[model samples]
Target chain A: MTTAPLGQLPGQTRRGERILIGLAVGLTLLFIAAPLVFIFVRAFAQGWQVYAANILHPATLHAIWLTTITAIIVVPLNVGFGIAAAWAVAKHRFPGRGILVTLIEIPFSISPIIAGICYLLLYGRQGLLGPWLQANDIQVVFALPGIVLVTMFVTAPFVAREVLPLMQAQGSEQEQAAVTLGANGWQIFTRVTLPNIKWALLYGAVLCTARAVGEFGGVSVVSGNIRGQTNTLPLHVELLFNDLNAVGAFAAASTLTLIAVVALVIKAILEGRRQS
Target chain B: MTAAATHTGAPIRAKRVLPGFTLSLGTTLLYMTFIVLIPVITLILKGAEIGPERFWRIISSPRAVAAFQITLTAALIATAFNAIYGLLMAWVLVRYEFRGKRILDALMDVPFALPTAVAGLSLTALFSANGWFGPVLDAMGIQVVYTIWGIALAMAFTSVPFVVRTVQPVLEDMDPALEQAALTLGARPWAIFTRVVFPAILPAWLAGCTTAFARSLGEFGAIVFIAGNLPFRTEIAALLAYIRLEEFDYNGAAAIALVLLAFALVLLVVSNVLQAWASRHREASR
Candidate 1:
């Protein structure tokens, strides 16, 4: 009764096997799903007023602005880098091509905290160029420029990594044809290659934006976390939590959670499109 | 004569077919050098400035060594769990057709998209004394928040997706006919899995686990919330580096940071090598 192979021996999983699969699924959902649900639940635990108040706080709004500005600046720059790197590495073969491709991926493996530390060393008051920067009245560390730079460093590889394989797979056939047809460089790229890799490019941009907005470790190191002045939304969440404002912290966290959800939705759609 | 003329002065050369090579490659190289490469060089230079003896002492300091120990141990524990859990998740995903399966598959990327800070906050909230799991765990005398377990938990949450994502495609592409043949040969499910399926997926799975381990080692935002950041106890290397920077001990911070960077760089090299070997093995077998 317990083990029913029935008519489908190869395809049909046994009951015990089914139970094991079910438990795996359940545990995964619990471990992964529960934390996501808990954030929003805690945010609204004290009803709408508390949630609204925390979210609308002046410092929170500033953090939101800083986070948005950082993403706005970093994502497009990384997108440009991604496209350029992908094109150079994928379309044309040259000496050190493999090294170039590998170098492009270096950021993916590097830790963001170390990235933040690197910038601090390069631009901080005590850094290699710190004295020069100080003498020149330019602030890189503990300021907006430092935050943007580190964010750029952390997110440098997203677009290139996403786009390279697609470009490589597509090859240079269309490009060669377009050249035969008398298309100029920009025209061929705009007309032929751009259309092909647009989806992957968008996928990379979305991912870049997600990381840019959510970046905490690197930004935290350089941003000085000076409340409204330097805190991005993630840093703001940390600040609020550290301030013992649990509700405020969760509310801020909910906003990021919302962004992450939207990004995931777009990602899922793009992935479906990529497959089909 | 025609070949010489074509080679000498053809207006449309094959090499020139895709123009902007120099321009694009130049920009890419420049950007990478400025953003990624230069910063790392500067860190190394800074580390170099600290005499070797002092640098050695800084990294080998009791606090520094403990942080590395905690980080490596926690990362290993988390990766071990992900190895089992992630493989099970991928297997369920690829082999089974069930209700909410697509949703489950889509949900696999939630960790990748979710902010680590947000993840840490929620996990900490759930496991803290007054949080959801807190009450249950309190009764059982188990503490997650502000402990090494919490550090491992956060790392596990953030890095689990690496294994699942890596293993899923490999499992999906596997020829089901192999499994069928194994079954027909009087092989039990366990034997078939261990002998047939495991071998094929081992390389990819190992790569995934290595990536997860490397990622967990560098994780900062998530672990800080749950880890309690106590020195020599729950403090991770990354956090300790940040603390050193905070205290204006640049050499100490740089030395610690270099050690972490070295670990990440080595793991990445190992991972690339493993992938190459895996592909070569696959090709030879084919």
Candidate 2:
């Protein structure tokens, strides 16, 4: 069936179908590709010096530092969470397994804006734990910790979502086999399960990193847009744009755009290798 | 099997074979509770604190209603466009062989990878009156930036990938025999698609569109840049919620946030139902 010539044979394109595909691809090129190109074009519109100056601007550099720090903190934690969650759900038969999976997915369905607001309401100076937090002299909302917290919230499901299905499909047979041979659980997992899932784990990690760095709504609400303090790359782009510094905004945006392109390139290569 | 017994003649203790279940599950649940559940629970509690009357008053206010209307309408428009464009893109991807097809497939994920803020900025630049496409559009008197159309465009850009990716796999997996059978019966290409191929992929397509719509509803970063955010004219519900929070009106923010949350939850339920239906149909078809 896979080799059959009956299903959508190449070179049999009908005129109407050709037109349809053309129209669709054309729309994508216009809407999707055009904007992407426009970012780079506009970023360099004033020449490389201006672009470099905008990029090396103190606030932009600070935003980059913050974004990188947030991703550095958030990705590994989520990777750990993903491994644990995937192991529990995929390797064990438990009551409420479905509920556990659904619970993990809660953040996915919730709006990032709401996720931000939820954190603010819980930790803001006027929030439920506001007085307690203030007395302790700890800041969450409008600070670095709040930015990390919300980024974690928004990017929570990526690693697990990517790795879970693969683990479930692979099953626990190998682990059981290793156990029968007197292999310790950790030994079996490290020697066997981890190797099998390493690719998926990396894929998930890449996705998590991209999302953590690019996240805006959740981080925006919590970061308070404090220049050179809590502002992330995304927030900096907005601040520049709001200040009507179009060149600076797009230049900062280009850095983010660069990260995204690199991510896409890596993801594409991984996907290609996976297919092979 | 014999390895389980021969090494230990002193009787094998039935230590659980798959260890770490308790520890892994414990950590997973604990982390989820602290990070995700607690904050969400706080939002719900806050929303409930405002009595039903006040909740209704906030949600029913003209500004809130307009936000909802604008969000829903834009999402609907985006979904409608994606339904056609996405299906075609999927068809092109699955059926035809072309140079750079692999690159094209990868390109679909750019919106997912690109920061929404970046997408918003670039799109606004491209469509604003002074931008490249902006001047052409201006000639046509079609203002996209700071308009509802811009909001819809942003939504469409960000969400179309859902439709394409979802439908692509299903379409690729479909058996050739189904289409062949239809063709053998003298069905035209369109007829075969409508009668055989379409039905096979319809459930998944619908599921994809629902998810796309759901995603569009929650979109904030991309839309906020393009949307003029005039309260009764262009502001989206997500932005409204954020605005309410900025003003320190916790009740107002919670109220609007709750509405968006409820909408998302409802869409999720609907999409899950469609997904289940799709799976059941696939099973029956097989």
Candidate 3:
């Protein structure tokens, strides 16, 4: 038998339900759906040849490559940290646990532009570490290293935040059981804990990858916007837009939009896996 | 029920068995210190080098004050819209059944997944004078691009999922029996929502709103394109800091960033406290 919704009683008219649903659908269409549709529309506004050329452009290719490399390096490091942080916080009780979580979450609240500025202060030629770096003749800001570092900083908390909750809820019972049965730490983690938490770990990595690939403000600050060099896909979009190349900008954006959609689809599947 | 286990004269702690506590916690702390902590310290140090007087002067300048005002105003406007829109969206998602609900749910996270620059670009294009919504809005005397409203729109778009995600699970887990009881008591739907439902989700909703506001304050990418970046007008505090850095005015950049950083830290603490209080309240009620 079908049960009535909580706020919907027999006394409520059908018209009221229709209106509420209509408003939500309409606004969602305007705010969320429309932008998504327009991305593709604008991307192809100049037709097939232009869209193909924009995507195949050398600068665009370099941007996609740079974005890929950044995500490749950033996601694994953050995922490793995520697992370690979750293991520490969830499996064991310790003093200052609360503080650690807050530290991890600092990036979520701070502006990305501020994150880039902070990196600059440490690594810029005249920064605190500037003299040391100059003596070493090592460039951090306005380079690939700077881009990676800031992306790492901005995305540091993703995996740990996602995995920590699931780990906490699962507790250490299975791990304890494994230890009682003579499993070593590595063995227990690999054979028991990994199988259980793998979905969450992957979920976090998906999000981290998406964020790393799309990072803009922070990366922009440090990358120096060197065309065909330190530029990423997101930065390329900005560069294209500012150059009055709206079609090319939208073309680049449509690629990122496609990536986002893929990420969401994967995220949805993982959410289902995680629930079951 | 079985009797509770009695404690011995001296409480005995369980022997630690899990490996990697030291290894794991050490890596976490060391990585965090290097990646997150040290950079932040440098920013603070950079700001401190300006000395109190100069820091004050830099932040109190007309341009700086105006940027802060615009940032706060736009953030407030964005947060206000998200507060109502978020609640309604959450309510609809949780309480109503409709086609494309799954798609709608997935789309809620686009703002999170989509790159900010793309969001900014697409939004600007969509709302610019010659674009689709631009003409409609322009004809209606409602300009979005390069205006405060545009900034707020971008802010709201990018932060759409904050409240929805936070409040969704809470709404899903809420005890519907109370609402059913209220309905049987002959209460209006609005009354039931206000009295019976809203209270249950109030802490989560507030926490969500606060986080959304903090995010709006820090937002840079989605805003810059649409905001027009007009000095003392569309320019936000973050953009001002970026401009300072571009001019090699490290001191000025640090001073402004320090203000934004402080806002973030305070809001972080507030959001954390509200979340803790929410869980505690839920536990207490249970």
For all predicted structures, in order, the TM-scores are: 0.96, 0.95, 0.96
lDDT of 3 by residue, B188-224 (tens): 7789889988998899999999999999999999998
Tens-digit lDDT track of model 1 for B166-259: 8887887777667767777777778888998899888889989999999999999999899989998999999999999999999999999999
- For residues B1-286, what per-residue lDDT tens digits would candidate 2 score against the true structure? 4354345554343333477888999989999999999999999999889989999999999999999999999999999999998888898889876666776777788889999999999999899888888999989989899999999999999998989988898887887788877766666787888888899899999999999999999999999899989988899999988888879898999999988888888988898889889888778777
List candidate 1 stretches off by more than 4 Å: A1-12, B1-16, B284-286
Clashes of 2: 0
- Classified by CAPRI criteria, candidate 1 counts as medium
Q: What ranking emerges by lDDT with the best candidate at the front? A: 3, 1, 2
TM-score of chain A of each: 0.95, 0.95, 0.96
CAPRI grade, predicted model 2: medium
The TM-score leader among the candidates is 3
Q: Score the docking of each candidate (DockQ).
A: 0.60, 0.64, 0.63
lDDT of 1 by residue, A190-231 (tens): 999999999999999998999899999999999998877998
Q: Report the number of the highest-lDDT candidate.
A: 3
Chain B alone, candidate 3, TM-score of 0.94
Interface RMSD, in order shown: 3.1, 2.8, 3.3
